[model samples]
Target: MKEIVKFSFISILFILGINIVSFSQSPNESSLGIQIEKNPEFRDVELYELKITQVFKIGNQGKDSIVLKAPTTMQIQSPQLGLKIDTIIGVSRYKVAQNQLIIYFSKDKIYDFEIFYSYFGNVANLNLIGGNLGSFYYWDANEEFWYFRSTNTKINEISISYPNNFYLLESFSNSKDIISEGTNKETFISRSIQNIPLQFILLNKLKYERKRVVKSNQYLYIYLPIDSTRNLYLNKNNIVKKIESQFDKVICFFDEVTSRNIDVIQIDYNKKGRALGNQIICDSSFFYTHHLLHEFIHVYSEIRTVKNDSGYFFLEESLTEFLAICLNYNSKNRDIYFDRKIAYYSNKSHANKSIFEVDKNSNENWDLIYGKTPFIIHLLSLRLNENEIYRILKDFYIHYSKKEVTFDDFSLFLRNQSVDKEVFSEFIRLL
Candidate 1:
């Protein structure tokens, strides 16, 4: 009777155009019978506003009808950033959610649809930008079209049409991706990458200047605003000297040489600095050496940690900041910085929360993660000498460089290392 009931339930699900088996697979895994080809076009590109049109060709290859839930909006929130859907075509019966569109399709049927939308206000500030007039545009292709768990999606091509007066100074993209430059319009094609999102950067020839420097055999690309006063030029030289002094220290400590060229763009943004892939976006007003070194360390020791996992902030931000200060500052300055961080964390109301409980997205928990967590790492370094701690971190980086690592995986790796059991237990207890 139980087996018969289970079979009937599955039959009902199939009749309702639902695939039960696909739910168990990974979010990016191929669905049972759904395939999607996407083409996105950006036009009327300006500093603060742009229009985007995306076309999707979806096909079903199974014997049963399927319900497709396609994301129809970009997940961005800003009072100044307004997103308006201008047009939609190719589907008559569809329901719209906050950021998703749901539609029903018949078996073996192919459907082509298009969505036109407009984005306004600080659009170029999505990653980072500097100067009075925006000089660069950064786009994360994946976030625009989020993961569809029940579909095999491929980005076929992308088109960007900018103003005629602005020339394409420099463009950056993944090696597998290709950009065909044109007078006012550019075409981007992805050769083999699927599901993985690629980042693209477009620089304006008139507003930005690029400098390429080779330090210790590693290439560094510095993009700065076109300044007539030569102040930025002098600052650029100072930045190179700082990098020259810190590059060997990072390599020696990590015991790894990152072959990829690093791009540092001086930008005016709310945040002090941020590292995306191999690019460092530093705020022009607050370009301190320690802050740049922190972002630099992020590029060198980049890890593929499971997103939003427990202790994610601890591993990504806390550890990087701790290592940056260790490598950048002298003993006295390091002690002062560590003491200040300890004091700041002690005063926070959320200081009682464990590192595992801190959320990266919550602004309230920022101090706990950035302040308390680093001090905790400092404590561990004290228990086991700094050299041993660095060795463990190096091993962790080598083992999990390109793999998705979870908090438990990190904890287990640390526990398996040859450390004192009592000290390790105390450290884990503190976290």
Candidate 2:
């Protein structure tokens, strides 16, 4: 009799908690107002039972889908209907009848947030995006309700009161249509870049999916269509190439491997196609190449020197921008602005600064790192001998390429080369 009573009690608590989930999804979720943040990453949302009262169609402003993010996965749900299941990175996507993901909270629970960037994929009440990951945790003891006070991602935050509601307004300039060339091989290379902000969309009518990617290599071959507006994109590509060519003489090697291995992309909505994972954005009349090669140089270089650890920001970024520029200069000799930037940081003496301090101070002088650090490499090349620096570059790539490197790991690499660490240490101090 005692065992039976205990089992019933436990079952009752589970039932009640689940009932709370359903109740929380009801219209009364927020008592003050619902404040939603527009974040693609869903990193800044604080959920505590804010229920959905209505579903507003986003119309032209929003895409026809839903977004859900978790630490290990990110999944997108099509707007076509009922609760459907999709999966990515281990997180599963589920549908909510209402356009909102309800979070229920007790009156005593603490919640706070502010507005964030609006790429939640939809603009009007027309769409919904939710998440089940990231530094996400639920605390049952706090309020006997599912409560979340934190997440892993960061963007501007938004706060909501119980009853109050705020509309999220987002705007984007008119862009071209998409041509989806679905191929996993193409996606693999695209995803490898790791810095592009891209959204993969599925077109139900045509039965296709595609994404805009970004990555930067020294050489980029862009094909433009003949339409006047399309030709504009071509012209822009030429101008961009001119700027680089004037600066560097690249030992150009053409590899059809990229386009051949990747999926076939047919032009869809926009005449100009953009690759977010790699640098390319198209407008009807023109497109721009935001090549990430220099950025990649730093990223790859950091990986070359440092194993992936906490001490990467300064050494990676600063050295990256610096070395990338050096590589650029080596390829092309033209640099007016880069020279001046290098001169500035050269005075700073590469001092020993905390990684966080450098990162935090970055908003003010980011270009300096990219420009100056590479320039330092140039100066070092002259002083240490270009052959030596080149050897370092080649060796760095050979050893650490494709593998994770650490800061201490890189420091040791330098020590082995008999490079004076203290010299560069003081160099950063000037910054």
Candidate 3:
């Protein structure tokens, strides 16, 4: 009996030690898992579907709950598992707002739970444009890229697979991460998808054949949109020649300040807009005239490391507008354009807010942000002389390219150049 008691006590102690080790290894840690696959059934242009799954581990030692939410515009599928807290397991409660889905769950005492949903349309992270050339998505060469991000959970790994028929065009990731098995192309990202941009391009050969490309180094390339229509504004050949010839002039204008090559995609879409980056997606009719020059200058400033802070729009948009006008205006009547803009800005009814006071929250604030402020920059240019102003812009680009800068920092930069404080101050007073 005594020997038996001693053996029993030893076994109890060993089991207790194992329990302690297990407890120590377990902590209140959470992760997010994601998988995106192309949908085959959808035939429309908006056929892509995304599956987002969020997992939360409620640490056994804690009571903090996890919240999962999505933009209200998304159509989330019903979650599979009901809420299980402690010994009690039941349905979890959630609410949907105009463009949001708010879900609450305990991550500490409840242990672990997963909530998932599917949404239609192309990935919001990718600006996808579809034409006769099929669907094209652009990735900025400069910044990091990610799909949806979680506020509280850390994304550990994301496995993304393209459509089985799609071919990989470009990928800047490690070769090991990208695997080609059978007809599908797969990439596994162990790195945090948060803000880490992927330099990649995937083409769906089943949708459209490869279009012609004019390569100007890795950064600069011109892609002609595939179109069978030789008439209307979507004329492929004429538009290509027009953009090529005009963009060549733009290259000469900012040649010294930027070596970053430009990628001009001749899209047939009827939109008259441009996104600021290494990529410029434009309608066939959009040339490298004043409109593009202005926008591209904005792009140049963006590629530079400027301190991004409030009130920097004066230096950013305004300066770009000023330069575009200066470069693209016919020498004979450039002043007419400047005077007309200044007069139009001066006549604005919403003069209650100064240019500096106009935050993004301001309603109908375009006149001040885009009009008055740029005219103010033009006014300052006149006082500082065109050469001095151009020097300031060039120097600003050289010193602060690809960096963050604020308005005060920009002001100090001008001051250091011995610009007249009174003149600069006058411009500030108007703003």
Provide the RMSD of all predictions against the true structure, rounded to 1 decimal: 12.2, 18.8, 14.9
| Per-model TM-score on C-alpha atoms | 0.68, 0.40, 0.59
Clashing pairs in 1: none
- lDDT for each candidate structure: 0.57, 0.32, 0.50
Q: Which numbered prediction scores highest in lDDT against the true structure?
A: 1
TM-score for candidate 2, residues paired by index? 0.40
Model 2's alpha-carbon lDDT is 0.32
Better of 1 and 2 by TM-score: 1
lDDT of 1 at 259: 45
Question: In candidate 2, which residue ranges exceed 4 Å CA deviation?
Answer: 1-292, 295-310, 330-338, 342-356, 360-362, 420-431
Model 3 residue 350 lDDT?
84
Question: Can you rank all candidates by TM-score, best first?
Answer: 1, 3, 2
List, residue by residue over 1-431, the lDDT tens digit for candidate 2.
Answer: 00101111000000001011111221212111122222333354432222211111111213223332321111223343212222112112323333233222233323221111111221121212212111111111112112111122221111122212221111110111211233211111111222212122111112112232223323333322223234544454454454345223212212112321111122222343323222232332321212233423322231433424554654556555445455454533525645666556556644333453444335354544445445555665555765687677666655675577765665577668878777556544543
lDDT of 3 by residue, 1-431 (tens): 00101111100000000011111223333333323355566555333443433344344434333344443333333232112111112227555443344545454444544433333333333444443455544555444333323354444433444565554444333323444445554534444233334444444464433333332421445555343456756555565566555555455555644234455655445545564344565654556346666656665554332434566556666666667776666534566876777777677688556756555634488777767777778778788877787788777767776677778777888889888989979977877
